[model samples]
Every structure is written in structure tokens, then in C-alpha cells.
Target: MSNSIATWMGKGHAAVEAPIGDDGFCFGSEPSLADVCLIPQLYAARRFEVPLDACPRILRVEELAGRHEVFGSAHPSVQPDAE
Candidate 1:
């Protein structure tokens, strides 16, 4: 699954144009439908120890999202079911 996700994200990275801002979100400056979808996948990929060195754009979006309150609150580590 991790390998598959890595491949999927690799394709997403190559298909997406460069971000307009310093952060590499696929859409506008704020998190959009693309981010809502991608961030969770990226989080899950990390849990499975998928190496992300190949997707710098995705990595940049992940970093920026990690700093936001909405994403932070929804993170697996902070979820009510976390253990």
C-alpha cells in the first residue's frame, strides 16, 4: 500500500504545476479540495514509513499544512480514537 501510494503521489507531483506561493499546495494559498485529499494520504504514507524524498512539492505542502490549526486538530495523533 505504501509503495502504491508513493507511486500515486509521484504521478500527482509530476502532473501538478508549480505552486504560485512559497508553499507547494496544488491550488491557491489556502488548503482546498486537493489538500483535504492529499494531506491525509501523505499522513498515512508516513505512518507506513514511505520515503517522501522524491516528492518535494508534496513535502512542502505537508510541511505548511502541519503548521495550520485545522490540520493539526485533525491529525491522527490528536484524534479521539488515537492510542
Candidate 2:
């Protein structure tokens, strides 16, 4: 979580890679809830400190997701206006 956001910090960035399961996995595939759970926690992770460069794949997914409407609605800053 914390690690995911730091990748966006720019100059000071470092990616944190996670282990693909022994079941065999690779980069650039459909993400799981594990990926879904990352972005918000990344906010907190930035507040603290987490390495990013270790996980370039996750960050790439983060960027790709950001371009989608679904991701936009899910973001706290994009919440619906109160009725």
C-alpha cells in the first residue's frame, strides 16, 4: 500500500515489487482485489514512507486505472455531490 504511492513522488521515487505467487504469474495482466486495495492505502503510505521502484508493474497499473471512469468515481476526491 504505502509502497504503491511513493512511485508517484517523482525524483525521490522507488518501486516496491511484490512476489508473484508460486502458482506462476507475470506482469501486465488483470489485477486482483490486492490491486484494488492499493490506491487508497497509497495515500497513507505517502504520509509515511514506502519504497516504490520495487513495484513498477503496480504503478503502471495505477496509471492505467487512473485513465478509466470507474477509477475516477472510486476516488475519494471524486465522490458524488450530496443530494
lDDT digits (tens) for residues 1-83 of candidate 2: 44445545533333223443322112335546655666665545545676455556556666756766676778766667623
Stretches off by above 4 angstroms in model 2 are: 1-16, 20-28, 49-51, 80-83
Worst 10 residues of 1 by lDDT: 15-24
The Cα error of candidate 1 at residue 48, in Å, is: 1.6
Q: Write the per-residue lDDT of candidate 1 for residues 1-83, one digit (tens) a residue.
A: 56787777666555642543555565668888888787887777677666677667777888889988998998888988998
In model 2, how large is the Cα lDDT of residue 17?
A: 38
Best by lDDT: 1
Per-model TM against the reference:
0.72, 0.50
Q: Can you give the lDDT of residue 8 in candidate 1? A: 71
